[model samples]
Target: MQEFFMDYGLWLLVGLLVIIALVFLLSGRRKAEQPIEPAVSAEAAPPPAPVPFVDPIIAAPVAAASVVAEPVVVEPVAPAEPVVEPVVEAPEPAPAAPAPAPVEPAPAPVAVVPAVAVVADGEDDLLRLKGVGPKLKALLIDLGITRYAQIAAWNDADIATIDAKLGSFKGRPVRDQWVDQAKYLAAGDIAGFEAKYGKV
Candidate 1:
């Protein structure tokens, strides 16, 4: 009976140890499954107090230096005064004497001649002569030659003087045989004029 008691007691001790281990595992598992609570922070600490602002007083010289940093404008200078020369007085001129009275010129001598002389019984048509047109007739009348006889009597000197005065009609006298035509016409010989110089 003593030997049987010892063997059974060992088996009983092992069974008790297994039951205690199961009890410890079950307690740890229950603790892990529970939710954890967060810790609260101490008071929220108030924000640090703001620092007081202060203005600095600057010196007048330092302020003036800042203003002087701007550009400066310079005005143009005025020109110098011009030099003046001394004025001199001119000498006075002598007084002029009274001018002498102008001398009167003597009257020119006047020759007495008749206004009209008997050169022809009456004026004839000088234009009847060859080369004598209305313009030539006017030029001849201006020279006091309204008669055919005057043209017939024209010498070389008279022809030259009259031709020079004729201007555009200068060579007409000699060119058309005006003197020959005048001679026949002055004598009232139309036949002679036509015979020597074709039809008048």
Candidate 2:
């Protein structure tokens, strides 16, 4: 081994130094060959604009010079009925019965009047006088007063008996008044009769 080193030692050292220099020269040449490139922007280009369409214009409206007028009317109406009347129907007459054959009145009975002469013009049916209605006549008949003299004969008590028997007359004076009227009737006096009853 010592002998081989001695023989090739210088040649190996020289060959190593030559290889290192060659690598340095090649690295320097690669750096010189690299070029400096100019800088370029990254922005993109814009597209073209679109065309527009035009429309026609319209005119304003015009007004008329004169206007016509219209008229209005109103009518009065009658008011509704305030009250209504009911319809009236007249009553029909009742059918009549056939009358009996006329019988001649029996001759007037002979009166048993006292001897005093009857005044020819004196009213016979004194109850028929004005102011003496059917009710009063019935009262006199119940009291046995067939004539004015009989009524005149009645005392106050007798007249009261008549009143009690007749019950309350719906609208006449008491028995005293009836007796007094009988007395006046016997004398055939109208003024005396009117004094007890109002004007006939």
Candidate 3:
């Protein structure tokens, strides 16, 4: 530090004195450059610029960003919850009037037995009839219905008896018209049987 001051101290002091003198001269010239107010006019005219220190570029967005703003945080509020109602079961209907005393029901009538000739006690080819396969023929044989006359004599009672024993083939006797088919077959009416049932 002592060496720096010794080398440049005098030169620095001379430069400072020159700068101060130049500033003094410039200030005096600036004061002289202003026009003298006329004594004739009572009012003073306004200068073109009132504030020379403030620059037009100072109004830019870069100058406005000098101060940092702190953001305000807010907690969200929740909406009110909806209310739920309880469920109830419906009641049974009310009864009022009494029903009429039930009548003594008569016995159901049985189907009339056809007057077919009682055939000899020999097993006929039950399979020759429509819908009577070997399994049914065996079932019929087991039910003591080996002859065509046996099937031809079937009234409601006989049909009910056989239907009770037929298992899966129960309703077949009535639905297939086995009694009617057997009547034609028992009468030895080939033309009638073939015409009624398809080519028995």
The prediction achieving the highest lDDT against the true structure is 3
* lDDT score, candidate 2: 0.61
TM-score-superior candidate, 2 or 3: 3
**Candidate 2 residue lDDT tens string, 126-184:** 56444467777766555445667765666555545554555656324242355567677
> Alpha carbon lDDT of residue 90, candidate 3?
72
RMSD, every candidate, angstroms:
25.5, 31.2, 18.2
Task: Flag the better candidate by lDDT, 1 or 3.
Answer: 3
C-alpha lDDT of all candidate models, in order: 0.78, 0.61, 0.80
Q: Which runs of model 3 end up more than 4 angstroms from their true locations? A: 1-121
Question: What ranking emerges by TM-score with the best candidate at the front?
Answer: 3, 1, 2
Q: How well does candidate 1 match the true structure in TM-score terms?
A: 0.40
For 1-200, candidate 1 gives per-residue lDDT tens digits of 87887998788899999999999999999999998865657886766899876434545667767775657799999998898877887878887887988988976433321133356567888767777899889987776777777777877767777777788989998999888888998899999898988787
When 1 and 2 are scored with lDDT, the better candidate is 1
TM-score of each: 0.40, 0.30, 0.41
- Provide backbone clash counts, one per model: 0, 0, 0
Collision pairs in model 3: none
* Candidate that scores best on TM-score: 3
